[model samples]
Target: MARRGPKSHWWRTRLLAIAIVSVWAVVTLALPFFNSISNGTGPGGVGIYVFMAEGVLVLMLALVFWFARRQQAIDREFAMAEED
Candidate 1:
């Protein structure tokens, strides 16, 4: 059995996290600008929106992790065969 280090997929994990946080940040920053024109539909406040986005981000990140791991496995196998 080969031992793989956590760093193998850490970048993808961190990217997913950053994307989640960015969603919250963008919504929070844009709400004020959007309100200046007309009402569509948005979070009442930043705090609540953060909670909502956090949930979405977490679910999405889990899926990202699943896919990334599968892809990594395929890549590792191909690399090993190429070395032979």
Candidate 2:
């Protein structure tokens, strides 16, 4: 059986964290502009809901990534301990 290295998993988790943060940053910065654009046209209050949803989504994604990284670390530690 072939064994996988923990380094690759660590790098992958790091990349995912970076990507999630980048996306969240972009959305956070752009929300105001988007809200203004939406509010300028009409009385529709949908933009606020959309922004809220996006915020929730980004938070959920961050939470998931955090848990996944934690689980990966635990697994790696267990594997190492088993090998010892």
- Measured by TM-score, how close is model 2 to the native structure? 0.45
* Stretches > 4 Å off in candidate 2: 46-84
Collision pairs in model 1:
none
In candidate 2, residue 58 scores what lDDT? 76
| TM-score per model over all chains | 0.36, 0.45
- Scored against the true structure, residue 47 in model 2 reaches a CA lDDT of 57
Which one is best on lDDT? 2
* Model 1, TM vs. native: 0.36
What's the C-alpha lDDT at position 7 in model 2?
81
Of the candidates shown, which would achieve the greatest TM-score relative to the real structure? 2
lDDT of 1 at 65: 78
> Candidate 1: which stretches are off by over 4 Å?
1-4, 37-84
